[model samples]
Target: MDTTKKLPLEMVYHWESSSPDSLYMTQPIGHGKVVEYTWGRAVNEARRMAAYLKSLNLPEKSRIGLISKNCAHWIMTDWAIWMAGHVSVPLYPTLNADTVNYILNHAECDVLFVGKLDDWDMMKPGVPESVRCISYPLSPSNNFETWDDIVAKYPPLEGRVERDPDEMATIVYTSGSTGRPKGVMLSFNNMAFAAAGGIETLGVGPSERMLSYLPLAHVFERTFVELGSLYSGFQLYFAESLDTFVQDLQRARPTLFLSVPRLWVKFQHGVLQKLPKEKLERLLKIPVLNKVIKKKVLKGLGLDKVKLAGSGSAPLSNDVLDWYRNLGLELLEGYGMSENFAYSHMNKPGRTRTGYVGESLPGVETKISEQGEVLVKSPASMMGYYKDDEKSREAFTEDGFLKTGDKGEIDEMGRLKLTGRIKEIFKTSKGKYIAPAPIENKLMSHAAIEMVCVSGANQTQPHALVVLGEEIRPKAADEAFRKELEESFKSLIKDINKTVDPHEQLAFITVVSDEWSIENSFLTPTLKLKRNVVEDAYQARVDSWYAKKQPVIWQ
Candidate 1:
C-alpha cells in the first residue's frame, strides 16, 4: 500500500526513475493518429511546464485554474500545477460562460490552462482577461500562449521538487445538484491516503490499461484514474471525441473500465438496437451459442478485454448489472462523494450484493444517521469547503464524520444500499414520505426508458417523468409503435406500483421530449439530474397531465 505520506509529484519522480521508458499514456489526435508518452517524457514535460509556471512568479500556493476536456496534457498540467507549488482548480469542460466566470472569480485564480474543448469560443469570454491563459496542444484557438511555446522556451526544473503532505493540493467544486457548487478543499495527505488504499485494495498494477473519458474535473476521475496511476502506474488512454469513442476503447482495450449509469444504459441500448432483447435472451439459453453471443456483443462494444467494470455517480438498475453479469463480466458498483476523495465503499469481488453498493474499503467508516442519511469517516475525507466556514462546519458531525447527504441502509453483511438523498425524499399529501430512488430504479428496468425522475411532493400521489431511449425515437413516427410503447410503459408502471406503498406509487408516467443535459442545466456534469431544474421546467403543466387520468401520458 506504500502508506508513506508522499505527495503525487514525489510518486511521479519515483516512477520516472523506477521505469522511465514505460508507456504511461496514449492519446488519439484524430483519424488513425495517436501520441504515446513514456514515463520519462511525460515527467520531463510536466517539469518543463512547472518551470514555465514558476517563471510567472505568482504567489506561493496560488490557485491555478485548469479548464480542459480529458487529454494527456490535462493530466500533465495538473502535475505541473502541483509541481509548481500551486493548487489546481479544474472546471468542468461542458460548463457555460456564466459558470466559467463564476469559478475563476470565486477561486481567485491567477492563471488558467485551456485545452481540448468544443466550447472554447463560448467559454473564452468567461476567462478573466487578467488571468493569464495558456493553451494546450489541440486547443481550438491560438489566442493564448501555447504549451509548446512555454516548454520550448524553458528547460525542465533541474532538481527534484516536492510538497508537504499537509499542503493544499486542489479545490474540487461540487456538481451543484443541491444548489451552488461548494469548493471542496483536499490536501496532499488525503490524496496519498486514498491512492495508497484504493490501489492496494484493488490490486491494480502497471500492466493494466484504462481509457479516460469521464470529465477530469469530477473528483472520481481525479482520485481514481489520475492518482491511482501515480500509485499503481497503470497505463491510461485518452479518448478523442464522441464520434471515435468506440474506436478509442478498441485501441486501449482497457482491462479496468469505469463508467457512469447513464453511459452504461446507453451502451446496453446500443447493443439492443441491433438485436432484440427477447431474441438475445432466447439465444443465451443455449450453452455454446450464449458464449459466442456474449463474446461478440462485448467485442463489438470494445469491452472484450475488460477484467473489471464499474458504475458510479448515481444508482444503476440491477438489470443493467445482471445483463453484464450474464455475459460473465465483473461489473461492480461503488459509493462515495467529492468531499471524501471518493475513497469509500466499493463492492468487492466474491463479496457483492447486486443492488447494494457493498462494504466500506479498508479505512472507510460508514453508518446510517437518525435521519437515515449516510455518514462517512475516512482517511480520504476533505479538509473542508474553501471560503465557507459555516457550510464546512455544518457538513461534518461533532466527532468529524462527513455527513453524506445520501440516505442508505446497512444489512448484517455491512453492505450499504442507498435509498435516496435526504433532501430528495418528499412527503405526499397523505403525509407519507416517499424515497423515489428505489422506485425509480425499479422503473428504469424497462429497456425503452433512458432517464426517469420520480417526483410529486405534497400531491395526492407521486408521478414520474421519463425520457425514452434513442432506440425508440426513430420508431416514434409510427402510430402502432407509439401505442405499443405506451402500453408497454403502462404495464411496467402497474407492475412496479404493486411493489411499493400506495403513496409511493406513481399516479402516471409522462414521456417528455425535453433533453436533460449539462448545457441545459437539467443534468450535472456527471449526468446526475438537477431535481430543481427538472421540476421547475414542467411543474405548471404537471397538474393538467395528472388530471387527464392516463396511465402513460405523453408530452
Candidate 2:
C-alpha cells in the first residue's frame, strides 16, 4: 500500500537484519522441520561460502556453473560465487546431458555447484575431470565437498565484494528452443534495477511469501523469485517436487504468484472440465448464473487467496484472462524476454486491456519500430550476449534500444497488444503474411485443446495441429467421441477464421492424442512450444490431415 516510495537495497537488507530471528528461506524436503534460514544465518552462510570460494584462487571474473532446481542453498551458493568475484552461469536442470556439457565447457567453469541431483550419472559425464564440483548439503561422493565443511573451514568475509554495478554478474543460458543456447550476459545493475522496479510496481514487501518451483536458472524466475525475494526481505519456500506442488502451494499460500501461460491454460481447463462445455455455456447465457459460476470456479482453484497473479514467458489468450478475471483474482499477463531481465511490461491490476501485455515497468521505455517490432529501453536490459559481440549488436538498435523480437502495437492506454513474432510469421501463396502465435493461442485456450501450432509456410492458407487435453483423453479416444471432438475443433476453427484475414484462416485442424512435451524436445523447459520442431515433426501428417478436408485424428 506504500505507493509513495520504494525501498532501496541497503534499506531492504537493514529490514532483514532487524528481523534476525525471522524466517528467510525454507524447504521441507530433507529437514525434519521446515528448514528455516534466518537473515543472520543466511548472511553467515553466504559469507563463509564466499570465503571458501575465494580460497579456490580462481581468476577474477571466472565463470562458475550452477545446475540445480530452486532451493535455498542455490541462493547461498550464488552469493558465494558473486562474493568470490566470479560470474554465475545458471543452466536449466532439465537440459540434456550433451547440452549441459556444451554449456559447462562453453562457460569454461572453474568450479561447479550442484543442488538437487536428479540426473547425476548423465551430468557426471559432462563435468571436466579437473573441474571441482561441490554438492550442497554434502553427499556420498569423493569428488565433491560439502557446504557445511566449506563454511566451517573458511570464515565469513567482513565485507561483501565491492562489485562495479556495470560489471557482468551472471551469464544465463537460454533453453535454446530453436538452436544452441547462447549465454546472455547481465550486470548487477541490470538485475538490481529490475528488482527495484518490480518491487515498486508490484508492491512486494517483507510480509509477502513466495513459493519457488519455476527453475531459478531462467531469468524470469531469477529476477522475480531470487533477486526480488533477496531485496524485499520476503520469505521464500521451495517446493519439494512437481508431485507435491499443490501441497507446497497450500503450505506457502503466497501473496504474489508468477506462472507461464501453459499453467494458466491448464487451470482454465480444470474449471471447464468440472462444469462441462454445454452446462457452462448454458450457465453463462444467464447473467445471474454467470456470476455464480465465476465465484464457484475461482474458489475451487485456491487462487482466490492470491492478491496478484501473473502469466508470462508466453502469450495468454483473452478467454483464459476473462475466465480468471471473472473470479476475484486479478490475473495479469506480462511480456518480457531473458535479455531484458524478464521484467519489461506488465498489466497493472486495475488498469488493463483484453489482448495487451500492459504498460512498461517503471524506468522502462517501450516503442514500436517501423517494422512493427517492439523495442524497449530499460536499465534492466542485459549488458550483451556472452562472447557473442556480433549477436549482441544485432539484438540492440543503433540508438541503444533492445529489440524484443515480438511484433506489436501499443494503444493510447500504454497497453502493448502483441501481433506476432517477427520470425514466426508465415507468408501464404497469396503473398499475405500470417502471424500464427495469436491463432495458436486461441486454439490452445480451448478446454479440450492442450497444445496447438499454426503454420502453412508453403501452402495457400494456414492450418492448426492440436493436442487433446489429458483429462478428456479417454472420452476423446473412442471413434464416436473422436468425431464429436473433431466437430468441436471445426467449429472453433471457423470462429477463429472469422477473426483473421482470409489468408490467415485455418483450412483444417488435426487432433493429436499425445501431448507435446519438454522431455521429448517439443517444448522448452519453460513449457513454450518449440514451433519449428513441432511443425517439422507433424508436417507430413498435417498435409495428409488437411488433404482429407475434414478433421483427422492422429494417435
Candidate 3:
C-alpha cells in the first residue's frame, strides 16, 4: 500500500502498529537454551541500539562494520545503524581473516560490532586502529560495551532520523568468484523495493514463518530473509549452526524458503540415496503408490509446510526440479545478482516455470540486448559501485538500465532461461561459439555428480570439469572407477549433444576432486562455479585435448 519510497524508519512504525506479543526470533541463546523475542521487544531493542549508535557523534552516513553470523541481534544492529544515520557494512562471519581486513579497510569503517566472538580473536589483527570495537549482548568476559549496556546507556531518540529514499543505506562487499572484492552501494529504496516485490509475488504475510540460515552478510539473505520479514511481519528463526539446520527446520517449518541451486541438488541426491533412481521411476508408474510415496517424501523433507519454495543466486539443475516435482513440491527457479538485490526475476506461485527463472517481478522490466545480455530496469537495482564512478559508468547503459552480465532468452510464457554468462561463453578456433552452462547442467543431473564447469576457451572443442556426489566414490584407486566415470560421461555427452549444436558438444570430461567449495573460493558465495578459475587451473592440459580430438578421462 505504500507507493512512496521506503526507509528503515517505516518498518519501526509498522512493527509498533502490529500485535505486541507476536514472535520475532526463536534461537538457542547459549548452552542449548532456547530464547524468543516478541515484535515489541525487537523494535525497542532496535530503537535503543539506534540511539546508542547516534551517541557516538559520527558523521552522517559514516560506515559501520558488522561482523557476525545469522542471528537476532545482527538484524537489530543493521536497522539501528541506518536508523542512526550511518551506513552498514556487513562482513561474513566465516570469512578468512584477510577478507575481513580487506572489507573493513576498504569501507573505511568508523566502528565495528563483533558478534559470536569465537573467531574474533583471529580477526582482531585485521581491524584498523582507527575503528572502535564492541561485542554483542552476551560476551560475559566483556571489557567492551555489550549491545544491551549500550542500549541502556542511551535510550531511543524522541523522534526518528528521517532519510531520503535515494540516500546510500548500505555498502555490501561482493567477493565474486574471479575478481577482488567490490563494494556495492545500495539505497534504502533498493532494499525496500526488493522486499516489496517479493511480498507481492509470493504473498508473504504476518502469518508466514521463515527460517533464516543463510549468511546475513550476503545481499540475497539480507534482502530476502531480513528485509522481507520486516515488510511482511513474518516470524524469523535463525539456525544455531550447520549441525542444527535440520533441527531448526523442524522448529520453524517455514512457510516460505529460498536457497541456492547447490542445496536443492544436495537434497535431490539425499533422496536418491534412500530410493534408487530406477526404483523411484518404477514406483511412479503405479498410480496409488506414487501419490502415497510423494506425500511421504514431501512431509519428511519439511517441504509439505512450504507454501512457496524458490532457488536463486545460481542456476539449478532441471533434474533437481523434476525430482522435487515427483515428490509433489513445485520448487521454482529465480535469477538475480547482488547488484540487483537478488529478486529481479522469480517464478510467482501458481504461475511457474521449471527451468526458467520465471518472469520479472512486479514493477520491474527486463530485456535482452543485441549481444544477448540481460538488461534490467528496476527499483531494486543498486545505486552504483561504492566510491567507483568509473566502474559504475560502465556497469549501466547510457539510459541508466543495469546491464546484467547474463545471457538469456525470453520464452513465449514470458519466462527467462539463462543460457550462460556473456563473458563466460567460449569461442573456439573453429569459429564456433559454445555456451557451457547448458552442458554443465546436464552433467550435474546425474545423482552421483556434485559440481561441474565446462570450458573450451581458445580450443577446438569444449571440455567439462566435474565433481562426484558426496556419497559417490571412485570404484577403486585403480582405473575401474575412472572407466566407469568415462562410460557415465559418454552417456551424458550423448544426451547433451542431442540438445545443442555441434559446436557446444562436450569433447572431454575430467572428474575433479570433491574439494571445490564456496569457502575455498572455487565458487562464489552463492555457490556459482567460477569458470575462469576452473579453466585457469586446468590450462596446462587444455591444448592436448584439441590435438587428440578425443575425449580424455582425467581423475
Candidate 4:
C-alpha cells in the first residue's frame, strides 16, 4: 500500500484510470435486483455530481450535509462534496428532527443531500428553507432536485479541486451515547494517514470484498468500509434492507467483515436457537464432527469465505469471542473513538487477545493517564471540535494526546482492556467503586436477558435492570416460562457474584417488559445503550426494587 496518495480522490482516480472496467461496488435496489458499477463509472458519476455542485458556485469550503443510510449513492455524494471543495457533514438516518436541525444549523450547512430515507416528512421540518436540497438514487419521492437531472444538465468536473493537506475535509458528529452530539473536525491529512495505516495494518488488497450495512454516518464504518475501499481498491457491497440482510450477505460473501458486539451476540443466539448448547459442545469434542459443525455454521451465517472478521464500537464478551473461535472464526475486538477518526487500536490478524483490544496501530501512540484514562496521539486525530474551542481544548491533554475518557489498562503485551467509562463508575454506600460495564456484560450472557444496566450509586449494593430477550418475551405470560426465567436469572446472578468482588456483585435483578431502541431514545444510532438515559428511566425503580428484598423483580 502506497502512503504517498495525498487524498482519497487520488486513490479513486488511480483505480479508475488503471482498471476502469473492474467492478467497484454493487447496490441492491430490491426484488432480487442489484445495480453494479465499475471504477470508471463510479468516478464518472461522482464527477458529474461534482460538476453540478461546482456550478452552484458556493463559497469555498462550504459545509454540505448528507443524510441517509448506507448505499452506493452515499459514497458518490461524499466524494462529490470533496471534489467540489466543500466539507461533508453526515447525519444518521435515524436522527430525530431536533437533532437534524441542531447539527445542520450548527455545521452551517448550505446544501443538503437526501437519499434512501426512512421518513423524509419527519426530517423535512428540520431542513432550513435557505439550504438547497438534492435527491439521490432510490429516493422515495421526487420532491427535490433529482440527481439524474443534475448530471444531465452539467458536464463532468474539469479537474480535481486543489486542497491543502491540513484543510478541513469533513465534520463527523459523535453518536452521543453520553450526551448531545459534537462535530469532530477531520482534515484531508487525517483521513489520508488513517487510510494508509489501516490498509497496511489489515493487509487489505484490491481483491478483498466488504459488505456495507452498518450506518455509514459512524466513523467506524466510514473508515473501514468507505475509506478502506478507496485505499485498497476493494469491492464494496451494500445491503438493501434488514429484511433482505441474510440474502444480501450470501450474495456478497465478503472477505473482510466488521460488525458490532450486539450483532455478534445476536448471531450466536440465532445459532444456539437452531443447535442447543449441549449439542454444540458435544459435537465440538468429536474431531470429525467438529469440522462438519464448523463448516455448516459458517456457511449458514454467510461467513464461510470470510478471511478476517472483527467486532468494534463496544466491548465484546470474552465468552462470545471464544464461542466464535470454537467454530474456527477468530473475532478480533478493536477500540477507538470518533475524536481520533477510529485510528487508535486494533487486533492484528495472527496475534489476538480474546478480551483485550489490540495494541496501538502504526503512527499511533497510546498511554494511560494518572487517572487511568486512555490517551492517544496519532496522525489521524481530529483537528478539533467544530465551532467549540473550549470543548476542543478540553478534549486533549497539554502534551496534545486526545483524552479518550475510557478507563483502561495495558497488559505486558500491550493489549488494552477497557474497564469502563470514568463517568460511568458508581460508588456504593459501602464506599467501594464499581464499574457497571463488566458487570453488565456478565449479566447479558444469561439466555433470557437481552440488555442489562447495573446501578447502585447511593445504595448499599448494586442491582440490575434487564430487558428480556425476544425469544423469552412472548413466553413471559406462561407460568412455566416465568418460573424457568426466574430460576435461570437467579442461577446466573449467583454464578456472577462468585466471580466478582463483593462491591461489584449485583444484589438483585429487575426484569422489564419494554424493549429498548433508538426510536425510544434508549440506544444510540450505533446500538450502544445510552447509559444516562437508561439510568434516568430506571434509577428510582431500582431503588424501590432493592428495598423489596426479592432476588428477582419483574415489571
Q: Model 4: per-residue lDDT, tens digit, 169-189?
A: 999999998777999999988
Model 4 bad stretches (over 4 Å):
none
Q: Model 1: runs farther than 4 Å from truth?
A: 1-4
lDDT of 3: 0.79
User: Relative to the unseen true structure, what is the Cα RMSD of model 4?
Assistant: 1.1
| Worst lDDT 10-window in candidate 3 | 1-10
| Residue range 245-342, candidate 3, lDDT tens digits | 77778888898888878888887787778988999889988998988888777666666698788777788888888777767778888777779888
| Candidate 4 TM-score to native | 0.98
Global lDDT of model 4:
0.89
Candidate 2 lDDT, 1-555, residue by residue in tens: 332233223333454467778888887665335778987788778778888888878898999998888888888778777777888998887777788888988888978887785666766777777778888762325457878788888888765346777888899898887999889998888888888788888877889988888889998888888888866778898887776776677778788888888888887787777777668768877987777776677556655457889888888888878877766578888888899889799999789898899999988899999999999998889888888889999999999999988999989888999999999998987888889988887887678887888888878888887777778787875889877777777788888889887777888876676668877889998998899998888776756665777644454
Q: Number of clashing residue pairs in every model? A: 0, 0, 0, 0
Query: Could you tell me which residue pairs clash in candidate 1?
Result: none
In order, candidate lDDTs are 0.90, 0.80, 0.79, 0.89
Whichever of 2 and 3 has more lDDT, that candidate is: 2
lDDT of 2 at 516: 87
TM-scores of the models, in the given order?
0.99, 0.93, 0.94, 0.98
Off by over 4 Å in 2: 1-16, 30-33, 138-143, 277-300, 553-555
The residue pairs found clashing in candidate 2 are none
